[model samples]
Target: MAKPNLPVFNSPEEQFQQLRKLIIERIIVLMDSNFSSLINLLYRADVDEFKLKKALAENPDNPAEIIADAYIQRQLQKIETRKKYRK
Candidate 1:
C-alpha cells in the first residue's frame, strides 16, 4: 500500500494553531452551536492547565497532541460514566 502524504507543520506553533482549530471544530459539531458559544464552552471546559503545562514542560514538541489526547480521554471517561449509570 502507498503511504499517504500529510502536511507536516514546520513548528510547534503551527501544530498548536491547527490543534486549536480542530478542537473548536469538534466542539461546534458536538454542541451544534456557533463559534461564539463554542468559544465560551471551550473556555469553561475542563482542560487542565496544570497538566497541560506539565506536558509542555516534559515534551515541548507535541503539546497539541497531548492536549488533543487529553480531550479524547475526557470524552471517553464521560461515555464510561454514562454507561455505568444507565444500568
Candidate 2:
C-alpha cells in the first residue's frame, strides 16, 4: 500500500506574514467601501485609538498598512495576556 502524504505546515513567520498580508488587503477594501465598519471593527478589537490615529496621521499614504499593523499588534498583545493569565 502507498503511504499518504501529510499536509505541509507553514513556519510561524510565514504564517504570520500571510495573515498580515490578508489583513492589509481586507483593510484596503474596507477603507475604500465601508470605512465606518472598519472603525467599528478596530474599536471592537480594542486597538489603541490614539496610536491608530497617530499612525494614520503620520502615514496618510498607507492607512491600510498602519491599521493592519495595529490590529496584529493588538491581537498579539491579547494572546500574550491570555497565556500569562491562564496559569
Which candidate leads in TM-score? Answer: 2
Residues 1-87, model 2: lDDT tens digits = 233333445687776777778789888888899999999999999999999999989889988899999999999999999999999
Off-target runs (Cα >4 Å) in candidate 1 are: 1-44
Model 2, residue 6: distance off in Å is 16
State the displacement of the C-alpha of residue 86, model 1, in Å, after optimal TM-score superposition.
1.2
Q: How accurate is candidate 2 locally (lDDT)?
A: 0.87
Clashing pairs in 2: none
Query: RMSD (Cα, Å) of candidate 2?
Result: 7.2
Q: Which ten residues in a row have the lowest lDDT in candidate 1?
A: 24-33
> Candidate 1 deviates by what RMSD?
10.9
Task: Please tell me which predicted candidate would have the highest lDDT against the true structure.
Answer: 2
- Mark the regions of model 2 whose C-alpha exceeds 4 Å error after superposition: 1-10
- My TM-score estimates for the predictions, one after another, are 0.47, 0.85
Give lDDT tens digits, candidate 1, residues 36-62. Answer: 654454356665667757876899775
